[model samples]
Target: MSGADIANVCNEAALTAARHNEEYVKLHDFEQAIERVIAGLEKKTKLLSPDEKKVVAYHEAGHAICGWYLEYADPLLKVSIVPRGQGALGYAQYLPADIFLYTTQKLLDRMTMTLGGRVSEELHFNSVTSGASDDFEKVTGLAQRMVLQCGMSPKIGTISYTIDRGQDMTKPYSERTAKTIDSEIRRIVDECHERCKNLLIEKADQVELVAQELLTKEVITREDMIRLLGKRPFANRNDAFDKYLASKDEKGDD
Candidate 1:
């Protein structure tokens, strides 16, 4: 039966019990049932293995640190090594904010964050693994967003180049323009990869520490991040490049 039908049944039962002077039958039964269901689901949350959890923590910590450090991205909220549904392994939560326009530097920094997790794995494990599958997906999506959605692409010009039905895909553009776009996409990916590599290299020690904390706590708070880093990266971030970072830091949520 529908939830409303069940509620109606409960209501009738409660009214009958009340007529017989039974106690505690006047409560909001539906709300109480929903709360119990929610609590049960919450208790069923899954977790990762020790090594995998550590990997997730450091991986996400890398992104959080890079975000706070860049001064152009969003401030780090909570960092979790906890495994979520769909084999997430771990996740880093950032404050959701709108992006109207992106500067070249901001776009670069975002790409760095998207790839930060995979780079962390390579740095820590002395070898790469499939744990970064998600990172690759995120990076690809970010690159496409930059080139196709955000117009940060230099070759495609300020206008977006999109596919429409009955349009030419084989002869999409001049051979020269097509080649230029390919070059631009590669440059964008290469530059972001380098940025992530450099950031991870510089924070090599902190990365280990953060990963260790994840192994211990399964989740790292913003305060945990600050304590591990000794200072916030947002403090000295570039204003023009990291304006959003500073703004999020100021608001101080998550």
Candidate 2:
């Protein structure tokens, strides 16, 4: 975020503290402020039916569970079923590491994490919903970049294609190559979706636990995740992210 964004967040956080009649701004106030800045204000007045709420809870839980298990996926910070922004019915936030480069496995893991919500809906409800439109968009973009720009696809040799988004001109490749690119993108996304579906199936019990908790509380923190799913398996995870959470926990104890 830019300096202006930071200033806005701090200002909003102070306003949140004032609204709560607190003598000082707290870490949670800043957290809420950041959420407001990123997700827009919470839509408490926007109501959902019982069935819709249940689907949302499970969908978010699927994301959290997938990120929790994936070795290269970002560490989950929070998950919530409470409606936010204009179109978001639920969301899963992750503490992404400060890394410059990404490996093929890492990218694939992230794609699987992105597909978790949709796969979860399919597994549990035996149906899919338009709620996954954003996920599909993100996954498709990443897969295209991986194949066309990054040359990560084995089928397509290492060749980077520059796409000028400003122009409606034809792609700088043969029609046959375009077909191959489309096929490669579909292959990558389908593989990630399968991986996500398998992971959710294996951890079905934990998904249920997290979903039930979300149904009751509407929000679940990192602490809640650890309690429900146990520690993440990866040993070399982000230390700074862990320390931030620890600091928040200590402040809550005070």
Candidate 3:
């Protein structure tokens, strides 16, 4: 199910590999394309110290472990500490659902995963760092969307409010309702963050093991994850991806 955008990236990566005298574009090229699409190209930052790399490794491992346990989360496909994009010391990639309607639990799972890295840094180092700035931004936006757009808030109760930033319409809700919405969003985010922290603490040993692997190997694939963590017990069992995989298996048998 390669979309036009993914195809474009893979083509670009393939062309670059060809220019470099590679006989064929390997799996590595495709992975680079995906990472590039999502996070821009890998940065050429100065090498991190042993301590810094450990912090990053555990941070990313936190995300992967959280995704592993959350049934509604996208599958944790791969993880790396190759210093991709600006300010990202590491990242975990997941296979997301290709649907518009996001369930409350699913959204909550996403926020939990988003905050997992920062929570990990706190747990391991007893302090936080600026590395989780993007995570915080994403978590806040998602939580706000859950409250304002999706009306997943019990307090808001099915009212979708849009701020008319372009001045096309008045801000959709009254000042009091807006305040309530903001409060609800904060509550949602705080709950998700606390839940994520607790999960990381509960699975501390597994987190440490995954980070140790990342330290040994800077990049790891889905198979590597399966081997390292056995299997994700709570992977979402229903999705279009399941049918797609079944079809592929059928085709391969022919």
Candidate 4:
């Protein structure tokens, strides 16, 4: 029979089995059925080099550790040293709960965390790698938002003198002001990078251990992370961001 014909036959048989043995149906039947279909279509993918694997491991571990050190970050779900589809050597996954507004301190905290992986590579490996390309993108994007959109920028004051729609993008600001904004962005990024580097340096030992675990097991869980780092630093205060969310959650005045 064709694959579709076979699947239909299997489904009919499973339905018959389910009617007869509901307990067995509840236990393993549905999962096994899906697994069989998935296994039939699976194909092997590319693997990673030893160095690339280590680089990815440390890079992802850096993100996990930094997030673990922050209060508002979601629980770390998984850390994998497995080579994925897009030549990624390792990756970490987290679910962001909510942050209504990005405050100056919170932005810096996030920037510091985002830069952690690259900084860890430098401190522990004595070199940098292309793995940090995505990280730099994230940090730069956050900095731009802070400077241009958020009014967090003291130089521009609280007033937003943004370019109007359909206006010349280049003509939005004078040549001198444009140069100042560029300089300001660089300065902010440098400061955050330095701060992140310092934080990683203090936790250098943890970085090495986490990377080593990733290399050995190919995955690390949240429990493993907590064992490595005691508690997150910002767990206590909401800053402006948390306050805004709380206000939204609360109903209208009493």
Candidate 5:
């Protein structure tokens, strides 16, 4: 978050504390402030039908399960079916690793993780909702960057086709190269989609477990996930987040 964002969160936290009749801004207040900043205000009045709620629960569970099992995807922090923001029916939060560089495999795993929700919808419902639009948008942009800017596409060679955002009508590369780039991007996303489908199928039972829990509770934290699925197989990639979870456990916070 930016400096201004941090300031806004602090201000919001103070207000939240005051609203709760607390003398000091507590950690819970700060957490509520951060959630408001990141996810907009909680929309308790925006009610979903039973069917819609089921879809959302499964969608978010798909995200959590994928991240939990993926070797390089970020660690799952929380998953919720609570309606928030303008259009988000549900969300899964992850603790991203503090690293500057990314590997091709890592990027692929991330894409696969993003695709999990839509794939899960397809597998379970035999259809998909518009909820997956944001996932597709991010996946497409990442795949494009991998092919055009990151040189992760072997078929396209180590070439940078990074376009200037200001120039909307000009092409730095030829029409044929543009076609090749499009094809490469499609290939990358398709492979990731298949990987996600396979993983979700292999762990379908775990997805059901998490989805059912989400339906009952509306939210599930990292500790809840560990209880349901056992410990994550991969080693910790974000020590700070692990430490935070540990502190919460030590305090016996719900």
Candidate 6:
């Protein structure tokens, strides 16, 4: 995925890097390029006020904390409260697994992490915000896919009612089946939301700590994360990245 993203950048990013006294684009340039492609260019001066900044800090801190505690979540890379893209007040970056493979547990954890922001808002402010619009869209899509496409829904059996691309004009399943699928998807997401919300509440102090620090620094790296929240859940995609880094160090004799 990242390789394809880099390809799409052509040499424009490399050229931009050269202007900074770099002879060639390094991996950091590509990393920044990818983040820009997804999250939009970082808006140096944000539109957020002091209170808004605090909310955003906690909102993003919640995401990082959930990812840290969840065994199946993608490993944390960084968390930031600086505004980026359209309305992204803040975001948590993760080192996702390379493979497309996903088990039910992993999917659930992903949904939980997505709900983290809303959960945090509700916990800290007794309200919610539009910050989680993208998260809910992602959660809904994953739940529906799990049921309708992946056939991971035991209640729905191993039946798939997937409509092919551009086939939305036709009904793939009956009205009753569609209703059932929608209900199931809602149930899955609602349950995960409550579970994640409770976890955030339980770890309220840690969440507050991370939020306070985020408001101070505006960005937190993996080492900063480890000091604040301890090590992530044991061995998964993050561990895989570690192995890759090790190999690179060996080859470069670093």
How close to the true structure is residue 12 of candidate 1, measured as C-alpha lDDT? 60
Q: Write the per-residue lDDT of candidate 4 for residues 151-218, one digit (tens) a residue.
A: 77778656554655575666567788778778878888999888777767777787888888898998
lDDT of 5 by residue, 104-192 (tens): 99999999999999998998996789999999999999999999899999989998987875858688899999899999999999999
lDDT over C-alpha atoms for residue 42 of model 3: 79
| Model 3 Cα lDDT, one tens digit per residue, 123-193 | 99967778899889999989888887786889988877866469577777789987998799889989998
Stretches of candidate 5 off by over 4 Å are: 165-168, 236-239, 243-254
Q: Write one digit per residue (lDDT tens) for candidate 2, span 1-254.
A: 77999999999999999999999999999999988887788998999999999999999999999999999998888898889987889988787877799999999999999999999999899677899999999999999999989989888889987688576677878889889999999999999999999999999999999999999999999889989878898777644588787899999999
TM-score of each: 0.69, 0.93, 0.88, 0.71, 0.92, 0.87
Roughly what TM-score does model 3 have, to 2 decimal places? Answer: 0.88
Q: Rank all candidate structures by their TM-score, best first, as comma-separated numbers.
A: 2, 5, 3, 6, 4, 1
Residue pairs clashing in model 5 are none
Clash pairs detected, candidate 3: none
lDDT of each: 0.68, 0.91, 0.84, 0.70, 0.90, 0.84
Top candidate on TM-score is 2
Q: Which candidate is the best by lDDT?
A: 2
Error of 2 at 109 (Å): 0.7
**Backbone N/Cα/C clashes per model:** 3, 0, 0, 0, 0, 0
lDDT for model 1 comes to 0.68
Positional deviation of residue 190's Cα in model 3 after best superposition, in angstroms: 0.9
Deviation of model 2 at 195, angstroms: 0.6
Q: What's model 1's lDDT at 247?
A: 80
Off by over 4 Å in 2: 165-168, 243-254
Selected candidate, larger lDDT, 4 vs 6: 6
lDDT of 1 at 218: 73
In model 2, the Cα lDDT at residue 155 comes to 81
